[model samples]
Structure formats: C-alpha cells, structure tokens
Target: MTFAAITGWGAAMPPNVLSNADLSTFLDTNDEWITSRTGMKERRISHVGATEMATLAAKRALACAGVDAKDVDLIVFGSCSPDEQVPNSASGVQVAIGATRAASMDLNTACTSFLYSLSTANAMIRTGVVRTAIVIGVEHISPYMDWGNRNVAVLFGDGCAAVVVQATDKEEGLLGEQLGCVADARHTLRVRGMGSGYTNSGVMLGDTEWDFDGQEIFKRAVQGMVQASQAVMQKCGVTPDDIDLVVPHQANLRIIEAVVQRAGLPMDKVMLTVQRYGNMSAATVPVALNDALVEGRVKPGALILMPAFGAGLTMCSHLVRWGDRVTPIATIPDEMPASKLSALDLVNKIRDRKSQSHEASHDGLQGARLIGAK
Candidate 1:
C-alpha cells in the first residue's frame, strides 16, 4: 500500500517582534495582564507580503528534502491572508520556486488550513495522483487586523512554514485525522469587510473589523480540539501516552491547556510557540511542528499529534508518524530581509492608515454584495 512520508520541513519568522509591552502603548492592557491571561508575550510583524514569506519557506523546504522544484508534482498553499484574492497564492509560490511542471492550488480552512492541505496532498499521493508535494501553512494577518480592538488584536502574528511530503510504502506520514467544523457557532468569530461582499460596497480592500466572543470561542475551541484529538487517537489505535509530542495550534494559552488536559495529555509533552509567536492562524501547527524538530523534540520513529481550530469554527486533529530521518538532507541560505521598524511602529502605521479611511469605508462595508455569495 502506498503512503505519504514527510521528508522535509522549514519555517520563516519575520525579524520584527511585537511585545505585549508594545501593545500597552496604545491599549489599556499591560504585559502582566496579557501574559497572565493568554500566556502570550510577543508576536511578529512582517515587512513583506504573504507570498514572499511563503516562497522563502518553500525554497527552504525543497532544499531540506534535497528535491528540485521541477520534480515536484503538487503544491498546496494553505493560508487565509494571501497576497492576491484572484490569482491564487499557490501559483505565486510555484512561479517563485520555479515549479514549472507542478499543479498548484490554495486551501483555506482558517487555522486548520495547514493540516487540511496536508490531508489533501497525502490522500492524492496515496491514490497515485501526485508523488512529491509541498504543503504550506502561512498567515500575514497584521494588515487586516483591527489593531485598535484590544479583544483580538493581541492574539495574532505573521509567519510561514512548509513541508515536503512524498510517496512511500512506509506508512509514516499522516496516519489518521478527525476533521470537522462548528458551523452553528461560526458567527461567534468573524472578520468583517474583507470579502467582495463588502469591497464591492465601495469599502477599502484590507479594511477589517473583527467580531469575537471570547467566552464562546474559548468554550467551542477547547471542546472541538479535545474531541478531535481523542477521536483521531482512537482511530489510529494509539493512546495519549503513545504520543511522543503534541504540536497544537497556538491561538490561546488557555485553549491549548484545556485541550491537552481534556485529551489526557501532559503539559510537558506539548510543543508550545504561543508565548513567542502568538497565533499565526493557519501557520500555527506547522510552525510549532517545525520548531519541535529544530529543538530536537521530534525523534526518529516518533508519534506526533496536531490539533487546531480556526474561523468558520473549523477544527481538526492530525496524527503523524515520523520516519527514520530527523535532520535535513540539505539546507538553503534563503531569508527574508530584516524589517526597518519595530513591531509597534509597524502596527501604528496600520492603525494610522485605517483611521484615515476606514470610517468612510465602513459606511459602505456593512452589507453582503459579494459577486458569488448570497
């Protein structure tokens, strides 16, 4: 039987850091309050576009696997914040990496995008549709974020990561996963004014306001992640103790802890990047996975569990079986240029731009007139 094996992994984090202290400059909250509540100390801000970070991550992943772009058969770019809405971001990465003969597409399921894209590529490889594929989990959320809103403003960052999965008979890639969504609860979390439904109403493209119910999101997120994690573990016939490491989405510290406790896992067994990177949405799981391997937390022939929840109230749990190799076969020197400003300054600039034009935009951005949606 054919199976998919993850042969390579790489991540790209921006040079700028946005600390909780920086957030205190404008908002009423301070470092102690933010840290005590969310377990998040800092996040990142990008000086470039989403496509650029994804391209760098793809190059590093391709090099790590010792695979050439021309040999790749598929590329799955998983992100909600792509550089362009029409052309598809996966195609941009394909061209950037010179994957001339590869088929490319984008997938967006909120924070679960990376894992879902991984499932897509794995299924295709197993069915003989594609041999080698690149799966990316990237988010450039700073641009669309409502920085003035303290509720959701402190919970996100910008980052990217990619993995190379290839056909194998070893059964060492994604063994099982439980995918689902809480559609009835979807209205609890939403970013207004992005889709054509609003842009068609004469609103600016990136102008956005968030609707976040902290209590509802927290309740639903923990329930979804815990159930999905337990279900996948049972499907794979593995218990919590069998999991070598749990690399979960870094949306909120409380959410992660709640999921782990309910799923019967230990805190020490989880790989955390929340305190440093906050929530990069779809980029969360892959970046945490990449960090695990880099920190030597991932071992040869290890069992890893990845659980995540995103907007649309989408949720999932992916169980991965590691292969014999943990080190990169090759490396790339590719990197993003250093940012010229601090995270706070960059955020301030965004706030300033929105303050100037968002009110005028908001008057028109309220209704749904998207071309394809009702």
Candidate 2:
C-alpha cells in the first residue's frame, strides 16, 4: 500500500524563555522543585497569538519540503489553545499562511492531537485523497495557564511544530499506526469552561480555568503510553530492539523515563526536547522529531517510533521508516532570534488589558445613564 512520508519538519518557539529560577520568584517553589518533578529547566512561551507560531513553523516546514503553501492539498492543525472558541483555528492559519488551495480544520485531543492528526493524514494520503498535507501541533499554553497556581502553571509552554506528509511509492514513509482512547478517565485533565454549552445563556463568563490532577495525570500518561507503544510495535511486527529511535510526548522527564523502562528500551534510544522546551503538549513529538532530524541522528531505513498520550486519556503510536535519502528542502538554524516579551512583560500586558476593558465598560454604563436622564 502507498504510504505517507514525512518529507519535512520544522519547529518554532517564542523568544521568551521562562526558566525554573524565574518561576520560583513568583511561586513558593524553587528550581529544584520543578526540575525534580518535571525534569524541565525552562519552556518557551508566546507573547504573540497561536497563529503566529504555527505559521512560522508551517512556512519552514513547507520550505523544507520544497513545496509552496498553495500546493498543499490539506492542512490539519492540532491544538488546545485555539485562536477562538467558536471558529476552528486552522482557518486562521490557512489565511495567514496563504494556503487558499488547501482544505483545513483544527483537531483537539489534548496532547495526543498531533498523533491523531498524523493518523488521519496518513489515511487520507493512502486513500488518494491528498498528495501533500501539512500537519501542525500548535499550543499557546500560556493563555490557558493558571499563573497563580504553581502545579499546572510551570508545566506548560507555548510552541508549534509542523511536518509535511506526502505520498511516496517508497516503503520508507509511514509504516503503521495504532490509536487508543480511554474515555472513562476523561476528566483526569480538563479545562472547565468556554464552550457552546456553557455560554449559551449569553451571560459572558469570560475565560475559563484549567483544572488537572497532576499525580493522576502523571500515572495515567505513563501507563497509557507504555501500552500504546507495545501495541504499535506488535502491529508492525517489530520489537523494541528493532527501533532505532523513539520520540515520545514531551510531557515530563520522569514520564519519558518510565515509559522507556516499561517498554524495555534503553534510555539512549529515546529522543527528548523536554529540558529546553518544557511541555508543548501536542507539539512535543514533532519538535523532538525536528531536533533529531537537524542533528543528523536519523538515517535512511532507520525505524523510528513515536508515541503520545494526553488529557483525553488518549494515546497514539506511529511506526515510520526514516527517509533520509530525500534531501530536506530547508533546515532551521542552530539558533533563532529570541522573543520580545518577558514573562513579567506578558503578565503586565494581561493586567493592562483587563484594566482597560473594565474602564471601557464603566464609561459605557455612565453614558447609558446620561441618556436615560435626558
């Protein structure tokens, strides 16, 4: 059967870096507290919109694939931090990136979003639906973070990773994929508000809060990923020893190590970007894939396995044959420009916006009172 091959990959992160030391200043926690728990020193966060990060990554990915945005047949953007709650975020991405010819939409399965998109894209390509597709995992996790709470606050970062999947006759593209979801434990990690069902009364409750059971999430993620990885390996008729590299969701360092141990895979076989970028949710796997590709760790015919588990209690695994023979269209620089906003600057901006909105509402109410008096 024809398969979808990842022809290009790219990742983009905000200029601002929120280090463990910086986080400790606001919360009662210190760098050691975070590092021990998460194995993360810092994470990238966007001061700009989610579209900006996704667009930058998509551009680089398309450039690397040697294809223009106009040539894309489909675009699937995966994220929890969407541009708006009503309209899909992929539409905004399509307009911003000038991908008028491509069909587009957004998919959300929490951190497992990218893998879900990858499975769907592969099916579409195999069925002769689309020749070239762009799959992106973009998250503006900062806006959704509860900065006042240290638990969820320090665990997330904003970033985007884009990959170009194209149909190829060679067997070295996507080989096999397996997906599993545990709906019984859906509430283990979730955001409380901002949905059609919630806002139907038009009372305008504004932004919702993110709620998560950290310990429960950690346990579930580790268990789910381990099971999913084993299932995928079985389906592909390959053992852990046959795999050259394993790219996993960059949720926590401990989780990665746990899954590796359970799968009986050596630590050296795992690819990680959690230390530098923290948890970008759905963007984690692709970002790690891009990092490995740029470092020339991936070679043609190498068997690469990717697994992800996320908030829905969702899990997905992909078995791919690394196609290094096809030259990359472009490559990201070893270093990119930094972000313009600091974490403090971002906080100030949020405060200023809230203040201005409140003042404007007060003025409107006073104007209505004056009109009533007349």
Clashes of each: 1, 3
Cα displacement (angstroms), candidate 2, residue 329, comes to 2.0
| TM-score, per-candidate, Cα-based | 0.94, 0.89
How far residue 201's Cα lies from its native spot in candidate 1, in Å, is 5.0
**Residue 53 miss distance in model 1 (angstroms):** 0.3
lDDT of each: 0.89, 0.79
Candidate closest to the true structure, highest TM-score: 1
Q: Write the per-residue lDDT of candidate 1 for residues 109-190, one digit (tens) a residue.
A: 9889999999999999999999999999999899889888999998899999999999999979999999999999999988
Global lDDT of model 1:
0.89
lDDT for model 2, on a 0 to 1 scale? 0.79
State in Å the error of residue 25, model 2. 1.7
Misplaced by over 4 Å in model 1 are 200-203, 357-374
